[model samples]
Target: LEDEAAYDRIASYSPYDNITAKPYPAILAMGGLSDPRVTYWEPAKWIARLRDVASAGPFLCRINMDAGHGGSSGRYKRLEEVALVQAFAIWAVERSAA
Candidate 1:
């Protein structure tokens, strides 16, 4: 009985339940296929839900098929992901400005 309230409170904050009609900023939902902690499906599902609910979209999913939750294990490979994020930020800014 005590946990019921907690469950309800937590459920109230769940993204799936709280989708609003308001416009949302561009979202980059990146994940790794081998990720055990934050599985790839989470991002995929989020992107799908956002597409369905949001008024507009620039939602993107970048999944690394060979990596895990921490992303690429090497320095150079990691930079590639970083670059993608930076590029996305720039693109979003340019898009919003225009």
Candidate 2:
């Protein structure tokens, strides 16, 4: 964590520090409440920061209450999440065309 250059190189891929004055793309980030790999708050915070810095973007995030990294435990619940993701994609595309 103390390696400044190394951390920068790795984190360069992340929008956290890379987002410029340019308008950001409409991003739809998903998080699972029970996810051990990526806690739900990570995306929530990222969206907030994106809103703060990016010139534009209807940044959106969804946190599944009954899920882990692999997503909801039930098939029906997982399907619902999948549908939501697809819908978000469509909405973003349409919004961009407008």
TM-score of 1: 0.87
lDDT of 1 by residue, 1-98 (tens): 47998989998998767878778888888999999998889889888888888966688888999899898879999998899899999988888888
Residue 64 error for model 2, in Å?
1.1
How do the residues 1-98 of candidate 2 rate in per-residue lDDT, one tens digit apiece? 99999998989898566766678888988898999999899999888888887877888888988789998767888798889889888998998899
Predict model 2's lDDT versus the native. Answer: 0.86
Which residue pairs does candidate 2 place in steric collision?
A: none
Query: Whose lDDT is greatest here?
Result: 1
Candidate 2, residue 49: the lDDT equals 84
The CA lDDT of each predicted structure is: 0.86, 0.86
Q: Sum up the clashes in candidate 2.
A: 0
Candidate 1 error regions (>4 Å)? none
Q: Which pairs clash inside model 1?
A: none
